[model samples]
Target: MHILVDRITEKTGLDPEKVEPAVGIMLNFIAKNSTREEVETLLEAFPAAEGFLAIDEATENKGLFGGLASKMNASVGVLAALNEMTTLGLTVEDIQKVAKETVEYTREKAGPEFTDEIVARVPGLAEIT
Candidate 1:
């Protein structure tokens, strides 16, 4: 995870702290929209993924409106994740860079087959990443 974060930080010029949350948001979006089996494979390939998801969950559930926001996230899909990332001070371009780097990191950790399947399965993900 450190290695991946370093790579994204170096390549995207995003803050180190922002990288994890951005990546986590993208991963959570993917998980929510893709097949369970494919997502499981992704989690297996990136075991630290669970930690990232947990962090995102904790961050999302932090305030009075957190619970409601989380529920809205479920119903709203990628928009919710995008909103979360933006709240972390990321722009659309930053988000795309993070998504691309994350997918590339997953490919390196897993394989093209595993990464490709998830990206293809998740609608609009191809365009974003």
Candidate 2:
């Protein structure tokens, strides 16, 4: 997890502290938007992803308004994830960099076949990463 987080920080120039939660939010969004089989393969390839997912779950809706905001954004997947990432101080470019690095890392850990399958299946994913 540290290795991946370090790699993201090095490449994206984002704060090390922000990388984990950002990645977690992105992964959670991907998992929600993808098929069950795709998610299983993704998780299998990157077991550390579970920890990131937990991070997102833990910090999802905190304040009084956060819960309402989350509910309003629930039907809008990418928008919600984008909101969460921005809340963490990540810019659009930063998010893209993180997503690309994450995808590249996944390709290295898993295989191009596995990574490509997930990307192709998930809408709006290829545009970013």
Every candidate's lDDT: 0.78, 0.78
Q: Which 10 consecutive residues of model 1 have the lowest summed lDDT?
A: 61-70
Q: Which residue pairs in candidate 2 collide?
A: none
What would the TM-score be for candidate 1 when compared with the true structure?
0.83
Which lDDT value does model 2 have at 72? Answer: 55
Task: Pick out the ten consecutive residues of candidate 2 with the lowest summed lDDT.
Answer: 62-71
* TM-score computed on alpha carbons, candidate 2: 0.84
Candidate 1 lDDT over residue span 27-72, tens digit each: 7777777677877887888898888777776777433344453466
lDDT of 2 by residue, 27-82 (tens): 88788777788778888988888888899899886423455533554345566676
* Superposed Cα deviation of residue 107, candidate 1 (Å): 1.3
User: What RMSD does each model have against the real structure?
Assistant: 2.9, 2.9
What candidate 2 gets wrong by more than 4 Å, as runs, is: 62-75
